[model samples]
Target: MPMAANEIEALIREGIPDAEVEITDLAGDGDHYAARVTAESFRGMPRVKQHQAVYAALGERMGGVLHALQLTTAAPAKE
Candidate 1:
């Protein structure tokens, strides 16, 4: 089964409590999604590493239940 947006957000938040996550259903099928995750914890980390963090948050569901996630990650902008 495809993953729900809230489930995805919750998983990411569980891993990075400080993250501000925005999830969009890209295809309206509940399978394809786009996630923009902003967190202070991502600071100083490379883009790949940041993505890895979010992936780790999702655990084993990445390629099985939660497939086709277009993820974008960034550190929060300074005010």
Candidate 2:
């Protein structure tokens, strides 16, 4: 019951509609992933807080369906 990349992306999008997400399969097993997400919602949030936001989007799946996620989150870059 590994989590798919699309599933992860969709969940993030559900939480932050304007999110720009790049998901990579770190292990090629669908269980380990790395995600780089940029969103306005992350503006002013601390790094840990930003990561928590993304984790919260996954709910209980964090330990079960989704094994591991390495995340890099930030507000969208200034033009």
Candidate 3:
């Protein structure tokens, strides 16, 4: 089964409590998605690390329930 957008958002939020996440289905199918996440936890982290963090949030779902994710991560914008 494919993961739901809310489920993906919840996972990211679990990992980064302050995350602002937007998930969109890239294809009509639920297996592919694009997620843009802004979180304080990403501050000073490298792009690869930021992506890794988001992936970790999904646990083992990366290659299973979630087939593909196009992820964009950013630190919270400075006020």
Q: 1-79, model 2: which lDDT tens digit per residue? A: 7889999999988977888999999999999999999999889999999899888887888888999988899998898
TM-score of 3: 0.94
Which 10 successive residues of model 3 have the least lDDT summed?
1-10
C-alpha TM-score for every candidate: 0.97, 0.94, 0.94
The C-alpha RMSD in Å for every predicted model, in order, reads: 0.5, 0.8, 0.8
Q: Give the residue spans of candidate 1 off by over 4 A.
A: none
Candidate structures ordered by lDDT, highest first: 1, 3, 2
Better of 2 and 3 by lDDT: 3
lDDT of 1 by residue, 1-79 (tens): 8899999999999999999999999999999999999999999999999999999999999999988999999999999
- What does candidate 3's lDDT look like per residue over 1-79, in tens digits? 8888999999999987889999999997999999999988889999999999998989999989899999999998898
Worst 10 residues of 1 by lDDT: 59-68
Clashes of 3: 0
